[model samples]
Target: MQLPMKTNRITITKITADDLEAYEKLISFPQIAEGAGFNLISNKQMLGELAKRQIANDNTFGIRVHDQLVGAILLYEQIGQCGFPDEANLEISYFLDPELWNQGLMTEALEKLVEVFKQTSEVRTFNAEVFVDNVSSKALLGQVGFQQVSTVIDPLVGRKKLIYKLEL
Candidate 1:
């Protein structure tokens, strides 16, 4: 909702092409990609295009610490995924640098973003889908007050998808 939101330990800003080089460092890790449920991108050109598309959409935010991009949080309208077909609902997705895992940075960032969204938007519900094996993400959503509502097999990936919801 707002640009450059500040949290207790990190700053959230719109992801820009300028941050792509540093953002690449976070996405380059196979573990991060796997945990975030996205395919790894090795080509800088494709990453550049993704940066442009993300910037134009204005839904993805960069998680920065002392001016360096270390991770990202994406909040966007949810449709036809996690059994949420309504456009009023939003899906929360994120990935953080592996080196910063278990440090509580993502929790803080996610909490602040949701708080801001609650204040700025009319939306009352947020949704998140995580693979059943991603314990950390499931824990993160629970910590932020999201309750798991359902579980379904992902036909594309053939994995159990846990659907989480947070109602503001």
Candidate 2:
């Protein structure tokens, strides 16, 4: 789906192979990966595979500023997996270029994602899990109307993750 440009001059669009180079660069930074609770990409081959997988899943969106990919916003639905909410719960996550830190670009992209999905998808809730140390992300989610639901150990991230929810 094509997301319209927002007043902040940002565009959030489905990622494709064309974005792999830019995406790889963004994720290769140790700070970016660590902040997002993912290990730093140590090899180009692994990064290539991950990029391809994201493009294939169609759940990842590229955040572009002036036509340059600077970040990615990704969503996961727990509906069919593990038989939990039957796909009614949507989980949101994102990574940004450290150079753009404190710029409000990420905040705009996230709010836009929530706005779009609430109008277009059957998903009942928008969810987010942030590591306990990521104060900025927690603040952003809260500012966008997501409430603190719980703090749980995330096996994948191996850290205490604070879950936030926004009911649409």
On TM-score, the candidate that comes out on top is 2
lDDT of 2 by residue, 90-131 (tens): 788788898997889998998888787777878788888888
Which residue pairs show collisions in model 2?
Answer: 79-86, 79-87
C-alpha local distance difference test of each model: 0.83, 0.81
- Best-fitting candidate, measured by lDDT? 1
Q: For residues 4-104, could you state the per-residue lDDT of candidate 1 as single tens digits?
A: 89987899998877876777667668887666644556566886677667655678899999998999887788675677656567787888888899999
Assess candidate 1 and give its lDDT. 0.83
lDDT of 1 at 44: 69
